[model samples]
Target: MLDGLTLDQMRVFVAVANSGSFRAGAGKVARVQSAVSHAIANLEAELGIALFDRSGHRPVLTPEGRALLANARDILLRVDAMRARARGLGEGVEPELSLVIDTLFPLEQVGAALTEMRAEYPSVAIRLSIEPLGGPVAGLLEQRCQLAVTVGEDFRDPRLELRALSAVPVVTVVAAGHPLARQAEGRTLAISDLADHLQIVLTDPTPLSEGRDFGVISPQTCRVNTQETKLALIRAGLGWGRLPLWEVERHLAEKQLVRLASHALGRSGLLVSESYLAHRIDAPLGPAARAFAQSLMQLSGPRSP
Candidate 1:
């Protein structure tokens, strides 16, 4: 009975389930509503299960249908991957090389990589996404990207390979007019003194580092999703936080923000942030992807500061 089931039927089932009605699903699959209904009816007949409960205004998945929905999605994903791999084998270049990068990676380094990538693979399409905290790694895990440059900590997967990129300099900073800046009399402040103010923290939506505060100094904390937002808050004197030195160099020089003495904050004078270029071990990158990755690595190579 299951042998009669086809990919078309599975697609129709998924479309109807997602869209909530045969008419809506028809619009999605570009077929007539009757055709969509027929496909699902045939699929249900073959599987001998009532996939949808159509008694209500909207169709809802039956218990058996709910059990099979995940399997159907997985099958479709595998089929898509097989098709993509086959296409890549014939073309020698990926149709699109999706690259996700951490926002903390120097903009100049990314620009250098993109310049080289464009020169080497003019025809290959590049999809670039900038994320922060756990987002870069999440992009890789969720199959949104084929590669990533990440600075997230303690995140590892057996299916991924990590290549060392470069270390970014992280600095604790505050607006020049901030209370902490005003209180510091050209000396480091004690932990208790610092804890009185708000310490902005960068947090990820993902559960990667649940209940953890990476560099928070104060018990009073503000959590932000991205570094740019954190930087903006620091500049507004709403809170103080850490940012990559390269990112705040201009602000520091312009007197918009001032770097705190790390020793007074009970930290080393220097905190080096490490980044990595990561790709999946199971799905090796195509030529264009490899070239783009190499370009990023080349630009991020060791240099005397």
Candidate 2:
């Protein structure tokens, strides 16, 4: 009974059912209306069922046709996925590219690079993680990710291969109404001025950087796990802290936050931290991973080491 069943017939049937007319389905499937009609007729004959009711002006799916439509769609989807995966395998592309990026890295650049990667390698699945401090390096070390974009210069591990990506400007910021902002109108505040205020610090969740403190000047401190939480607390005038300048540019422009003039941070109160593209020296980059890494480098313009 299923002797005449073919993918072409099922495709035409599904197209006609979805389009509600034989002519439209023919156009959709890029075949003539006669071919579409012939395909549907063969499919219905093979299945021994009336797939469509032709009594109406436009064809309507029968109960049996409605029931089979979902199966047809699912089959097509699986076939497409199979073809894509097979193509990727033949071309030596990785099945998936897992990447872990430092939370301080600009998301806009990441998004742009991903957009390009998707267009170039549609079959290669992406697994992305945004982690703070040593979390990114930990993911790479634990084999959770194949590539990592990390901030700072603490990556001295011989197991990793690093390439300088770009420098991100870190700036100390406080809410416009914070006491420090009000007191430092035209003068640079000394480190002693910040000692009393509760500095909302981003703490590393991983033991890889347990004993390290980056740019912490406050005696009274409030530790947070995520940058978003720290930013929220800072916006609430609860404390002051250093954040990537790109992250707080909008708030600075809107007058919601004010940049602190710190004598420790020199004249501009900006610290440029180098971010790097890292991967294990032992694990060679697959095609997809290499492509994505190239895209990131192109987007950020790789810095001279």
> Candidate 2 local accuracy as lDDT?
0.85
Worst 10 residues of 2 by lDDT: 80-89
Task: Judge candidate 1 at residue 123 and give its lDDT.
Answer: 87
Top-lDDT candidate index: 2
Q: List the residue pairs that clash in candidate 1.
A: none
**Model 1 score (lDDT):** 0.81
Q: List ranges where model 1 is wrong by over 4 Å.
A: 1-91, 264-269, 303-305
lDDT of 1 by residue, 37-155 (tens): 99999999999989999999888999999999888877876666676566656767667878888877887887788788878888888788887777778888898999988874567
Tens-place lDDT per residue, model 2, 139-239, is 88898998899999865565577888888888889999999999778988888998878999988878887777877888799999899999999999999
Q: How many residue pairs clash (N, CA or C atoms closer than 3 angstroms) in each of the candidate models, in the order given?
A: 0, 0
Worst 10 residues of 1 by lDDT: 262-271
In order of appearance, the predictions have TM-scores of 0.68, 0.68
